[model samples]
Target: MEDLKREGFTLVNGSLGLDLKHCQLVLRKIAGYHAASVVLHEKNPKCFNNFLDNVYSTDCLDDFGPVIRTIFKNCVDMISKWPGYGTYVDTLRSLEDTIVSHIRKANERDEAMYNVLNHGDLWINNIMFKYNEQKQEVEDVR
Candidate 1:
């Protein structure tokens, strides 16, 4: 907390409506992180495997399946009701099966393409920005 304060980064209060520049900055940072992890994994597969071995498994997904489906269904329904969102709603509904398959495949240890570590819970809350105080532009991301 003190480090953040010293760096002129305060926890942004209330809801943030990120503009295009903020989104681009965050995407670039995340992409760099992912690329670095992929390179590290390629350089030391054994180390990556050992690291993953100690991580939590998704065996509890069986219990959470219903909840996940319900959430997705609710999202589709809500989006469908919005004007000009029909195409998006259709695309989302169609992708439900694909999403489930991807999730399952993502958990498979044998899938080399999915071996790289990723931020599994990326959201606005998990990101911090160091802004240029004078210009109020994002200068750094953490």
Candidate 2:
């Protein structure tokens, strides 16, 4: 994360919309991080594999497609019973389908692509925001 930040990364508290400059700074950082990862994965497969774990591999799921479908199906079903959390659950179900499709496609292109060190919790609340006056936007963030 420090490396990513050094490369000009800044994460926004999604709940609080930032100025255009702030948004651009955050995007550059994110793009840099993504680019670095792709480069590293291609240049040093062993090292990359050593530091990552596949979250959506066939080994982890008996049948990748079915497992993904089942998870989404479960989410849809639960949404009906849990009215308070249903909206969130339903949204997640939609995301699950998208994520699964991406995983499947990535797997076909590069079987190792699904592996990465991911922060399991990635929600609006987990983030905090601050702005940089000199830059006229958001800068430092975690």
Best by TM-score: 1
Write the residue-wise lDDT of candidate 1 on 1-142 in tens digits: 4577677765554285677887888899889988888788778767775556422345666556666777888889999999988979877888665555556655666663555577878877777778998988778877
- What residue pairs clash in candidate 1, if any at all? none
TM-score of each: 0.77, 0.43
Question: After superposing candidate 1, which stretches have Cα over 4 Å from the reference?
Answer: 50-57, 88-91, 94-99, 106-114
Q: CA lDDT of each candidate?
A: 0.72, 0.59
The superposed Cα distance between candidate 1 and the true structure at residue 137, in angstroms, equals 1.6
Best by lDDT: 1
Candidate 2 lDDT tens digits, 1-142: 3455455544555667666765565556556666777777778878765444454544564357677777777767877687587567656766665766667455443454533334446454544445565764555544
Candidate 1 lDDT (Cα, 0 to 1): 0.72
